[model samples]
Target: MTPLGTAVTAGTERAWIEFRRGFTNATDLGFYVVMSVVVFAILWFNRDTVVQVPGYELPSATYALPSFVGGLIAFLSVLGVAYALAMEREDGTLLRAKSLPHGMTGYVVGQVLRTTLETIAGLTLALVPAMLFIDGILVDGVGGLVWLPAILVLGLLATLPIGVVIGAVVRSVRQVNTWGSLPLFALIWASGIFVPTIALPQWARVVGQLFPVYWLGLGTRAVLLPDEAAALEIGGSWRPGWTVAVLVAWAVAGVLVAVPILKRMAARESGSAIAERRERALQRTY
Candidate 1:
């Protein structure tokens, strides 16, 4: 078999092993399940609140749930991958992988696949519950059954590799908070995920629109919200085409950026590098 093919096969096996391992560990599974709970609780708290948009109104919980889902997916994908890579890098995991032929590729592929599965499982916990209990969700009904999964797959494609790239670029796990999580948090806040874009400042709106998160939230809202909820958006429309265009662009660019950087990152890994990383991490802790 070709080297790449062998790596992929190995990676798939690794992902399955990790995913199943997660299922057996209650603490880990419980921790992952908390996101869904927190999100659902947020929605439940505002379940009855109504918001007045230009020509329409919606229950805030109903309105926010979809955006929250999209934001959470991006948040989890980026931070999760970033932190894992950073921690593994510090602890000699990447160094070990570097000793194997094509192991970096397998490692990257495994991380991506495993995280995607985890994200899907985590979100399903929130979505299925919210669908059952929250009013005005699944607004498109049967059609939503189609659109929701399609949007999720696209959003994952768009965001996961961004995570990979971020993971590759950061020097250490500690830096991930500063370089990856904080920036992502700021980006989501600027985007319309937590609040309506119409209410954000003009520059914030412009900045939010520049990234994939905004489009992801927009796309999810398009499905989970009523058609008129589009009025609450920046242009007073859903712009489904724009959502697809932006996400696809990000997916392509993220892969291009992540691959070479990840290769460079793996190339630099060594026992000495990991020891230096740990020493620095220890100094920071002390």
Candidate 2:
């Protein structure tokens, strides 16, 4: 097989291997469940809150569902990939991959596949409970359900490579907490996930509009909520065209920046570096 073909095949196999390992492990499952549980609980508790928007009359929690889901997409794509990359490098996965021809390509392809599947799984865990208990979440019924996958895939594309860049750059998983998780959480807050952007300060509205997270939430809300809900959004509209453009732009930019950085990070992986990282991890356990 050609180098590209070989890399593709290797990556596919690698993704499957990672998925199986992750699903079977208790810790991995917990990591997947905890965030979803928190979000569901928050939405569930707020299910009875009065929603008094003009012509926008559904359960308030249902309206908020899109933001939480979008934020989860951002969280899993960016922070999840960063942590995975950081942990794998420390565990010598990269070093082992380095031994193969075009290994970096295969490794990256594997990560992309692995993380996308994981994101879908994580999203399902969160949304399933919301759908079951939170009435009116699927306000548009069958039509809205059709839009869910497209919105999810778009949101994932918009944010996944950003995670790749972060994971590739951070020195360690500990650093990911400071650099990756903190900043993502900050964006989640500022991007109008938990609160409406219109309700935020002018500075915050602009800042929220500048990122894919906001657009993702907006796109999600556009799908799940009724047309009337747009009246509650900034500028009193969903602006589907703008949401798609902005998300596509972010996805393009993230991929452009992430590719070379991922290659550089992979190039730096070596047996000695992996051994040193392992030693540090071992020390941390003591």
Candidate 3:
């Protein structure tokens, strides 16, 4: 097999291994499950209040639930990438991977695949409860179902590169655990997950518009809400087409930034540098 083919095979294997690892990690599973339940329960309980908007019809409880769930999944996937990279760096696994042929490419592919799987799994888990509680989750019918997943995938793709950058920069697992949650919290809040963007200051709305979270929520709202609902102003009127374009731009930008940063990280991880760093860390702790 060609070198690229070998790398692809290795990446696939690594993805499977990581998926199993995630399953075995009871703490992570419990965290995700509990969060999903809480978010959905809150939405279910507040369905009447949410639907009480003056003119537009509110989204079904099922629809709102999935959007929040999907957003959480995306956030957690990014966190997973950061945690994986940080732990590998601390454990010398990253250093070992760098010694293999096409290692950097394989590692990047593995991270992407693993994150994608986790995101999909999380979304699925979130959807089940929504479907059970609310009728007609898709406001746009079959079209919404088809387009929603595509848009969400794009949104996740847009965020993955940023996750890669974070993984590359963080020095250790402890930092990853501590710092990772902050960004996730900020993005969810700013993206209008819990509150509409219109309620925020003008500048905050503008800043929120620049991130993938906003576009994700926008696309999701488009799928779940009626056309008249889309006309509802949030951060200066929601535009589904514009949201898709912006998300694509973000994904492109993420790819542009991630490639070089990942290369730099791979170069730095080579030889004995990571090992030496880990050794120093151990010594310092002892």
Quote each prediction's TM-score. Answer: 0.93, 0.92, 0.88
Off by over 4 Å in 3: 56-63, 177-179, 235-237, 270-272, 279-286
Could you tell me the lDDT of residue 71 within candidate 3? 71
Model 2 residue pairs with clashes = none
Which stretches of model 2 miss by more than 4 angstroms? 139-146, 276-286
Better of 2 and 3 by lDDT: 2
Q: Estimate, for each residue in 1-286, the C-alpha lDDT of model 3 and write its tens digit.
A: 9887798889889998988887789987887688668767876786665443557566546336645854775586678788888778767777777788887778888888988888887777666666676754555778877888888788888888878878888777677656776867776777766666566678777777778887887787778765555544473455777887988998899999988987887777754676677787889799
Model 2, 16-59: lDDT tens digits are 89888998899999987887788788887888885667855667
Q: All candidates' lDDT scores?
A: 0.85, 0.84, 0.74
Top-scoring candidate (lDDT): 1
Taking all chains together, the TM-score of candidate 1 against the true structure is 0.93
lDDT of 2 at 94: 81
Q: Per-residue lDDT tens digits of candidate 1, residues 55-125?
A: 77788988888898889889878887888888888888888877877888888888999889888877887
